[model samples]
Target: MTRYWPRFNRAGFEESVAPIDYLEWYIPRLEELRAHNLSFSGMQYNWNVLDLLGDTIADIAKPYMGDVDDPKEIIAAREGVNIENVLITNGATQGINIALLTAIAKIRNKSNGKITVAVESPTYAPIPQSALILADDVIRVNRYPPKDYGHWRINYEEWSAALKKSDILMITPISNPSGWFFHKDDLAWIIDQAKISNVTIIADEAYNDAYREIDDYCSIHSVAPNSISINSLTKVYAMGHIRFGWIVSDSETIAIARRIFMTFSGVMSSPAMRIGTKVLQQSSIVDEAIADYRSKNLPKLRSVFAKHGIVWNEPLSGVFGCFELPNGIHSELFADHYCKVNDLLVVPGTMFSDSMQNWVRVAWSIDPKSFELAVDALDRSLELALNQKQVNKSK
Candidate 1:
């Protein structure tokens, strides 16, 4: 038997965070704190359905009992375009997997076995992992680091060239670690390039609603009808437990994706689907949740980053904000020190990709106080790291 060292950079620090343990450890403490009028470590607000929605969850769940065949009901209810354009899945992760599998099947059918995928650098880990596991050849194009730390720029020529020889292109709006979203014009150009190259585009908009302002957000589905847009109820809704997500695309793509899903996961749990339908139907509930998060927590996050002199891009939308350390400490080591000594958890940018070594992602979804405490912990950690570097240099 041989032990396999994990090649993915962030896995070790993530393991240290013990996400499952964090949930278990935090949930009970959160519940107990609720009794004392203290906030918990998640972003969802405590508003009643009546406060956010005119309809009840039960009312929303009543109409979709038959077979889940009509994608229109889900789409229309969620205010998306049409039925031919949507495929509901277990979550965004599942939608991404399905998209990759669908892309693989399409390319393999066309190329007789050779299938290649092009991805943006500093991309979400799952994109590369899925491409490696499912596609034949993978090429990664790198995005430029932001000049001001708050703004990011992508090289169009590099991205366009990569798509030319690839069968599929994977991208995320409001990238996971950087929270840097592409401009609508830039996104449009990319979509047009894909159309010309005859490549399938997979747009992961998992943080779709996390934009700083709703009007600034644009969906790639509008730009390219053929592209698959994947979204979830996790980040904005703070409903990670719901595990609901969907892919929007053309009918042919939906049919193939559904077939792949049926053969793979059979059907999503009935209860999750029921809750998901309820959640989606209440548009006001979603809006209110986003508003509450932005109004109450975003400022705290901004102030903390300011206090530490940590440079970061203000997230256009989503629970995550990316910041660069002042002293350029290795992300993994910095994050590990924060967690081990202070019980503060953060996702290292390295988890996203090697290009993100100087940055780290902080989830704004945590309680306001927890965020402040984490910032304080980070303050101490940064000083200690700087001191250690100085000592090493002196020696």
Candidate 2:
């Protein structure tokens, strides 16, 4: 047997951080709280892990031993068109990987068998990174400004031109780092172009339930019947601990994805699949989780950012909100400094894409009190970074 490091694209080089813990970087603060000490800095908030796992586990574990041929409960819960359209996996990350491999396999025999995946500029890192792993080339289309951030706006002409050359197009309905919901009209146009160009659209709707209004959000799967939709229980259900996700598309796509899954990993554990099924079937639990995020946590996050003079695209839905930092502070360095010195953590805009270097992503799905602490820490961190930069320039 030979040992080889996995080849990763540029996006792969960035380290992965749990979205919740990433914001509360201070371990000592947490320890103090555990010891029943009152803290001034406010770093102790986190998602109720027990609430997420305890409620869903029994349902998830049931399908494994039961006589059910298909997880009807989970299938109906997702509102998927049919059982054939759904393929469960470890998480949305797994769904993305499967989608890429399936796309490559389908196009491997074509003239330019090498797939070109087009992604939105300032897109989620995994989109381009996954494409690079599975395709010959990756093209990026910028949808928002890099420096002073704003809403996601697609340049239809640019997208259409790229569509001609691309074999796959990846988008997040409610984007990760941006928290910008795609306009229905833009999504419709993209679908039309994809159909004409023979490009497979992979819509990562991991944050699907995070929208402010559920009605306003449109799944790419809805517009492009052939498009592959990827979703997970992590964001919407606050069940990241369960590590369950699924892919939805036409029957053919699901079959191919299943074959690839068998070849890659003999079988997904019965446990994960069962748990996923359980979460999907429990509609009330899912709805309650969504409501908690929408009504309570989101408003608190928006006010905190506004109070600090930070602006973001008011996410119509999703767990995250993206904000731009004041001038002279690099997002990566600022994030690193904040985490290390101030016990606060945030994803640098650079992690999302090169064009997002000046931005930072804040996950608001955390406890509201913890979110407040994170916001306060962020305010102080930004001021320190700015002041330090000015002092250096004077020298």
Candidate 2 off by > 4 Å: 1-73, 145-150, 298-300, 386-395
Tens-digit per-residue lDDT, 51-109, candidate 1: 43354454544545573344347664453676766777888888889998987776677
Using TM-score as the measure, the top candidate is 1
Model 1 misplacement above 4 A: 1-64, 67-74, 77-79, 212-216, 387-395
The models' CA-based lDDT, in order, is 0.66, 0.65
The window of 10 residues in a row where model 2 has the poorest summed lDDT is 35-44
The residue-by-residue lDDT of candidate 2 on 48-157, one tens digit each, is: 43453575555544545553346534653455477777887778888899998887788788835567888765555556767765676778776764334545778888
Worst 10 residues of 1 by lDDT: 1-10
Candidates in order: C-alpha RMSD to true structure: 6.2, 6.6
Query: In candidate 2, how many Å is residue 333 off?
Result: 2.5
